[model samples]
Target: MGIRSVMLPAAIAATLCAGGVARAEGLTVGFSQIGSESGWRAAETTVTRQEAKKNGDTVKIADAQQKQENQIKAIRSFIAQGVDGIFLAPVVATGWTQVLTEAKDAKIPVILLDRDIDPADKALYLTAVTSDSVHEGQVAGDWLVKAVGSKPCNVVEIEGTVGASVAANRKKGFDDAVAKDPNIKIIRSETGDFTRSQGKQVMESFIKSVGGKNICAVYAHNDDMMIGAIQAMKEAGLKPGQDILTVSVDSVPDMFKAMMAHEANATVELTPDMAGPAFQALNAYKKSGTVPPKWIETKSTLHTSQDSDLQQIYDEKKNLGY
Candidate 1:
């Protein structure tokens, strides 16, 4: 196996100190990541490792490559190895009952990071550390509504992977928000699988079908998709931020850079430090037998180029594995 290097800031070194954790050091946890599907995913993986190393804990990782079966296998392997705990970034929202049950039977706690599974049983995992994906979509939609107030703006949306809870909720949130404004309508929608190339390809097809001039703005499920859509629009001789509005999620460093360049309008921030809270909960549980809540909801804030320190933020986060 080869090593992928990443640089975490000094402040993140103490990330696991939250919730009055009882210093549960040297615990070995297994992480089943959903592959490096996007820049934010890679950054989340890096931050997970960085936080674990800070507290002298060990992390054994399995790259699921965006497949639920692989993640199931990884969880079973972690259980067999008697790891202290497991961290799961589920590829999809369902098909987790048997594997999660196995982990529970083995008396190993599992923490979900960056996403949630279906709420078939809340006892399946200790807690979910994720942002409100639905709200993220709403944030984008609200921003676009305010940007083009009361105009007959036709929106073309690029969705994430099918069956993923984030995708479903984001789509619903955006659609619900825009439904309030009769003038802002979604003319076209399709899955981009949360990848840049696929986003660009989908945007190209949307442009050809709907005509870029008639389309008013673009809303992508994530910023990686937005970046690709921006490229596609430029290739078609459409000025993206100016001629057609842009909004998406994930305040990654690249998105901030684009905002500075005035190519992308707005993004919702999805922090990659999910492991920090997960580790804290595990530490508190192991040392004091306290059960963490079923869901640890993270914040989803909006960002735009109008911010005073966009460039500084871009420079700071450039090496965070994004």
Candidate 2:
């Protein structure tokens, strides 16, 4: 994810050494989460704690409930407590210069998960562990193009929270990919705020404005929104997969279940184990003063019901707290 459409710089540097490395032994790390707004966020928190346990680190988690103010407050609290490190899943991209600068002044390293901060000043954080959201969106768009072939398809888009780096980047990737073919056109688009209720509400408005039957597909930034869109489609007396193709990001359990039921098409996997790499970087930096690369990328895999065993994947990820 980016404050810009492009990815962050890939330069590895000693900027991480600005804050003295963490002390050996059980370290206390504060985590400022974006909140359990979706299944993926919940699984991310769960996996973060699991990663902390694996590293014998004490994680002090603060739920921001998807507010920038709450996240800034949580980071200040972590700094006041003098935690060894901080894990921040930023609710939005900009307006972070002040708090992040404060963290730097306190000599606390902040590792970003899921979202990236504005690169106006990259020195504020240590490093970011994130997936290629643009690529994820491109994958979704590519799948839709191939599925529809040369047939004219009108798509309604369910976007994530506005101003989020991930949301902007995903939209850019999808928009760019779909631009390659004039046959695929996005007819309606709105922000779902990355919530199911808002997603359904937006889809409902889209259906009324555009004539549901005229729309060929729905592109959601996340699976939760796609599931909500599917519900809206069903309630409106339309078969989801058959009547309107569903393509979204975030391969959560419910998405796979919908896939098994043939209600959704494809979802690009946004792994919840973001903490795995964040903790790894923290540990390495603490133990031996290792400065990891500026951006640590996690793989984004595309899952489709048509080519894969949806049930087996659902069974594997159902217990993952998503």
- Local error of candidate 2 at residue 6 (angstroms): 52
Indicate which candidate wins on TM-score: 1
Clashes of 1: 0
- Report the number of the highest-lDDT candidate: 2
Task: Tell me each candidate's TM-score.
Answer: 0.77, 0.75
Model 1 per-residue lDDT tens digits across residues 2-83: 2322334333333433311443558888999999977778888888889999978988899999888999999987776677
Instruction: Write candidate 2's Cα lDDT for 1-322 as tens digits.
Output: 5743343332211223333244447788999999997677888988888889998888989998889999999998788667889999988779999988899998889999988878578888889999998998899999998999999999999999999878998999999999998999999999998888998999888888998899999999988788889999998888999999999998989988898899988899989989999999998888899999989999888888785678888887887788
Q: Which residue pairs of candidate 2 clash?
A: none
TM-score attained by model 2? 0.75
lDDT for residue 88 in candidate 1, whole number 0-100? 95
**RMSD of every prediction:** 9.1, 10.2
